[model samples]
Target: MTKDKTGRLHVTVRSGRKRKLSSKLWLERQLNDPYVVRAKREGFRSRAAYKLKEIDDKYKLLKPGMAVVDLGAAPGGWSQIAAAKVGAVDRKGRVVAIDLLEMAEIPGVIFAQLDFLDDEAPEKLRAMLGGGADLVMSDMAANTTGHRKTDQLRIVGLVETAAAFACEVLKPGGAFLAKVFQSGAEAELLAQLKRDFTTIRHVKPAASRQDSSERYLLATGFRGQQRP
Candidate 1:
């Protein structure tokens, strides 16, 4: 590791015979990433914690005594930020997180190891929340197949599912946030969101890698009911 001009450590990885070039590059990127280093120092589960933090700082999404649901919340980075902002750690707020993968315990979060797409997921999450949610956020991403169009479709599908779930359990003034790609195919999704939300915007936080095509869709002021 060597210090860059910003005084951040940059790691260089050598590709061994057994290591694939892609894997070596990924490892190097992770090691040199400033947010990864900050996450470690700050004790967050993943570098993604900064992404939510930056978004929340600007949007004021999380508030004390609010109920929050985190879809695909493995590793609990977003959960951590929500818990802190909502005072979940003090038992004044509620946070329910669900994912297909088992996540280790997070202090103020209720973790459910299940797929959000399951028919039983929404009811289970509502029970865990004990009431309607004030905000529903998802950082879920589909497994990439290296085909851009296919991956984009999958991502949009995931976002749509998440939005549907949000509509089922969110309060009248609730908000929804989900990760999405920059593909132009999101027009349909945006149209749907506009029908359901009073305001919708696409945001790319600084914490998101500049080179990455990933962006977030934020929909605020839910219509309180789903349209036909």
Candidate 2:
């Protein structure tokens, strides 16, 4: 580790014979990332906590007494921010998180280990929320297939599924936020959201790596349920 002229600490990773190029690059990025260092200093679960923090700072999507549902919430980074912002610790709000992978307990987050795609998951989450949710957020990403087009399609499919679940569980005039890629395939999803929401916006927070194609779709003021 060494400080550059700008007073920024830089970490260089030496790739061993056993370490793949991708793994070495990823480790180096994590080690030098300011958000990762900040997250550790603040005791957050992961660097992802800063992404949600930056979004909520601008949009005010989280409130003191809202009911929030976090889909694909593993490692509990987003859930931690939601719990604190929504006052879940004092029982003034509710935050329910679900992911296929098991996560360690967060102080005020109600976590369930289950696949969001399962038919039973929606009803179970609704019950846990005690009714409709004020906000539904998803950071789910599908497994990549290496082909760029195929990967984009898979990401769109995952976002569509999360949006459908949000439509079913969000209260009238509630909000939905989900991670999406910048690929052009999002047109269909945006069209659908325009029909269902009063406002929709795409945002790429500073916490998101500049080299990454990731962005977030934020839709607010749902216009009630739509029948197909």
How do the residues 23-109 of candidate 1 rate in per-residue lDDT, one tens digit apiece? Answer: 999999998888998999999999999999999999999999999999999999999999999999899999999888999999989
Clashes of 1: 0
- Name the runs in model 1 displaced over 4 angstroms: 3-8, 226-228
Give the TM-score (vs. native) of candidate 2: 0.96
C-alpha TM-scores of all predictions = 0.96, 0.96
Measured by C-alpha RMSD in angstroms, how accurate is candidate 1?
1.7
Residue ranges of candidate 2 with Cα displaced over 4 Å: 226-228
| Candidate 2: tens digits of C-alpha lDDT, residues 1-228 | 788789998999998999999999999989998999999999999888899999999999999999999999999899999999999999899999998899999988999999888988888988898888999998878999899999999999999889988888888899999999999798899988998899999999999999999999999999976221
